[model samples]
Target: MLEQLLIFTRGGLILWTCKELGNALKGSPIDTLIRSCLLEERSGAASYNYDAPGASYTLKWTFHNELGLVFVAVYQRILHLLYVDDLLALVRREFSEIYDPKRTVYNDFDETFRQLRMEAEARAEELKKSKQMVKPVNNSKKQGQAQKAGFDKGNKKREGSSAAGATKKGWFSSMFQSIAGKANLEKGDLEPALKALKDRLMTKNVAEEIAEKLCESVAASLEGKKLASFTRVSSTVQAAMEEALVRILTPRRSIDILRDVHAAKEQRKPYVVVFVGVNGVGKSTNLAKVAYWLLQHNVSVMMAACDTFRSGAVEQLRTHARRLHIPIFEKGYEKDPAIVAKEAIQEATRNGSDVVLVDTAGRMQDNEPLMRALSKLIYLNNPDLVLFVGEALVGNDAVDQLSKFNQKLADLSTSSTPRLIDGILLTKFDTIDDKVGAALSMVYISGAPVMFVGCGQSYTDLKKLNVKSIVKTLLK
Candidate 1:
């Protein structure tokens, strides 16, 4: 359903649900209401009432004066938060913790957040003041020229000071905290947040180790600075940490290209690819997309619905097959996956298909029986490529999963002597942000060439892996 309107106001969080807007307003604070306007033309009462999540309305509060309140919201609360002042307040609060006698990752992240908030507020103020100043009446032409000059000056100021300061703070503080695992202050967040961080960093990658060391250095630096500046810097550091996380989780790149197929490659032929990952990580959707890509490129493609364990897996694959107008070899959900895979391979071979993509049951990497099932499929059909489709947003657990699966697959391949696996297919690249050092490190550690990346859930969102393009997109 479409939202009729977005109302903004300043007050406590309150909401009312009634059949009509007027009815909702009767019990509300009249002074706080900005205005009441008809959102849509309705004949009678609304008849249906829905209470939206988050605050009932957003408000333009005094950001700096109520900095602590805003920080509490931005740091720990919800909603699609977007406000210049709130960001600045967060930065200030978090930065203070960073420069305190104790420093920690929590503190570092908060500090960096503060710096960005400050930058945004400073820029916003410049624009606001510049637009409102009085102008001469007689010379309209001169006024235009004068305004342009003022804008240029403001732009220069932003470029020279505030912007640079924020960027510098973000970069340095993130780098420092990434190195320091421990600091003077302690983290008091939920265990899951900490566990998520620990799981991500446990792989002993270069970035993770460096981040641990950086935090320690920042903690040591707090010894000499004044309380105010220390607190401020700490906030900047905290903001940087959050930004780093954003960068890591968001995918800035797409994998969309196909490698040139040679006859030799085909002789070693029957290009079998397997997709594996946890549920809702775009596994089945990714398989469909791959099928579409292959058919588009004029390669004879067959999809094997070996994901017999999942209830909707076969039907979902069948849906894509119908959409693409391609052939699919699938057993119903109750059948053994190995049987499905074996039959699919035989069918593909009989049809002279160039590519046979198998969609497997989803599982966490540590599921031993699942791993055994995968091994059995590999032995029976001997897929040329085993692309583990992992969610980029999973943070550190993803790396551990990769490590476990890669090791298991390697061992199975050595013993069974089927066609060696080719590479990985990283799904959900769009969710990863620009500074995805952690995810990149995970890929590097996996030691598999990431062949494809999924930009979105749709069929056309899949892209051929290009490292340069990936880096550029994320940074953007």
Candidate 2:
């Protein structure tokens, strides 16, 4: 059963609720759905989840942009509610027909919702039965053999192609180059070139999914536009892709930490930056690097050793603090990292430190217990910046890590407005050379800008992301 459905305005006015859910949803998940996802331009996500003290809810939402109405459905976590999508669509359609912008109450929608729910459920049942009757095909061995046969033939022809393919080289590029006159571009005209561009991006370490999306976006932009004469379709496509990459890499929000730090210092509060990421991504080391960057600007910094679950995490941070000649805060291992971070922030304030770098344990995104702890620390401390430390060497896993981090933080937060990752710090930048596609993937996934990149093993290895140069290298 659907736990509840909500209809509201974009301005946060509730027009209708399926039931008086009361304090069961004490933290106000709808408000969170707005803050964490919709406000952050992540409404493209399939669904949102909120965990309460005694219950967990999965939320799916839809919007009528012209009508300025938001429709949401909430259900229990355990139920495989396949009909939620249908139900949301049904409500959106029926309600849009009768919606009044001047009205604030929608008491009459209850009956319409009841009938819509039953129809959606019936349609869902039919789909479920139809799906169960289908059987799996045992095509793996046949496919494997066919693949091997094709590979053998390709290898045999490789010698001949190497000798003659020199002239066949740029065969695709030649088609674009041979186009003499200006004409309106069609999808068919761009297909081969965009396919090559997409493949080129994949070879350069861009995630296949992101590469496909980027190419599709470029196609949409270039489709039907008048082409200038003598413009190679390939070069035009490349130029469009280049522009797209630069837009994606450019920071949407203010990522100027130095300015924010001074503003926080004027308020006499330490600018807290929480470093979080999965295992061995160098959270502590990069946290120290950020501290070093601040120190060079004459900002007093304090290190918060909140990686209490990991052995030697505190010692490692302590060593960095000693080398940097800054104060270090720790409560040893097996302590609540949230409290440790809280105390560390207070210590920074007491000592008049300009910034507090909170080093958290590197944890896999699916680790719920640890993720809850991380959420608690963010809620408890309300850090000025939550920088997710990711490796530039990653490929598709980069999106997975960044998306899961944002999702887990939104799902596990104790506050109605949970803090998502504000910025990203791409480590191991020197290792990735021109395969700089992970930066694009991470930024695209989280919609957070790449603020700092760690290029070497020293304290001064940190640098801000250069959008033009990275885009140039990506399209090179």
Candidate 3:
């Protein structure tokens, strides 16, 4: 059943509600939606899931940008609600026609909503039936496509070689040959260049989806622009693509760890940072690297062996602690990680440590039990930063991992304002060479900056992300 529906202004003023004030939402689901999704520029996601003590919620929101209104629907997450989106659209249309900023209550619109919900549900049922009827045909088509795919797989290398050789004249040069110094650029004119760029990005290990979107963005920015005298289309396209790549790799927010550490020192509290990622991505190794970096600045650091699930996790951090001449807090394996982290922070505070680096067990994003435990630790401790330690060699899995990690953090959080990944630590950077598209893909997907890259096995091997160098390598 749908729990609630709310209509409000972007300014945080409640205009209407489907449920009575007596039965208003207990947990701030709307607040969570705005904080974890909208404010993070994740409005493009289809739905957001929130959890409360008794029930979980799936939220769908639609914005009436022209009128500065937000329409949100909240329902039990256990049920698959297909008509929620249609209902939202219908309500937006019908309500906006009657919406007025001066009026706060919408008593007369209840009748319209009753009729709209019925229409939306009816449409969903009819669409579901039609899809079921066509399921067999779709299955047959999929089988045919699968066979064609296998055949194509055998000839892929040949086709790729032919395409690569076909670009001997260069994609942009081919266009220049056709256009012969055209004054204005057009979308169709950039097709060859875009295709070449996509292939180039894919070769560098960029996800196909990210490559496609980057090409589209570059095409849009270059389309309808006037060209200069003797300017080759190749040069123009290269410059635009370079600029786009650099923009994507650039950090949008402040990633100054040292500054934040000093700020925490002033407040007499430890600057807590939690390192997390999948199995064998080097969370413990990178956590030590980060501890070394902080120690270099004369910051007293403590390691929290919150990775209690792994076999050698605590001993690993203790070894790092011994080498780094820092203290470590560990209760051994099978202990609650949240409790361990909490106790570690308390010890750090008592020992006058400037920073607390929490190393958690490596886990696949799809592991629900581990994910929930990770979320609990984060929610309980509220670290100053959550650095996702991902490998630089990851390709398309980079996007999937980061997105699901953030999703799980949001969905499993105990509070309205959930703590999400604030930064990234890219391990095995020296091994990747020119294939630096993983950084771009991770940053683009999570909107979190790559704060440090691990270049060696040594503790002092951490270094800052070189955005310009990466852009040059990608273009090269």
- Per-model TM against the reference: 0.46, 0.65, 0.65
Candidate 1: Cα lDDT at 413: 56
Instruction: Please give the CA lDDT of all the candidate structures.
Output: 0.54, 0.85, 0.85
Model 2 residue 16 CA deviation (Å) reads 30
Residue-level lDDT tens digits of model 1 in 336-395: 788888888778777787888899998776777777788788777666667777766665
Give the residue spans of candidate 3 off by over 4 A: 1-181
Residue range 34-116, candidate 2, lDDT tens digits:
76666544454678999876788889987775566778998888898999999998998999899988888888888888899
Model 2 alpha-carbon miss at residue 199, Å: 0.7
The TM-score ranking, best first, is 2, 3, 1
**Native-to-model Cα distance after best TM-score fit, residue 39 in candidate 2, in Å:** 15
Off by over 4 Å in 1: 1-207, 210-269, 411-421, 469-476
- The digit string of per-residue lDDT tens for model 3 on 1-476 reads 67788899978898888744225565888999876555433454668898887778899988775577889899889999889999999998899999988999998887788888889999999999998884444557888999999999979988999888887868876577556666567767778888888899988888888787777656655665666556766678889888777766777667888999999999999999999999999999889888888888898999999988989888988998899898899898999999999999999999899999999999999999999999999999989999998888776676789989999999999888888999989889999888988988888788798999999999889999989998888878
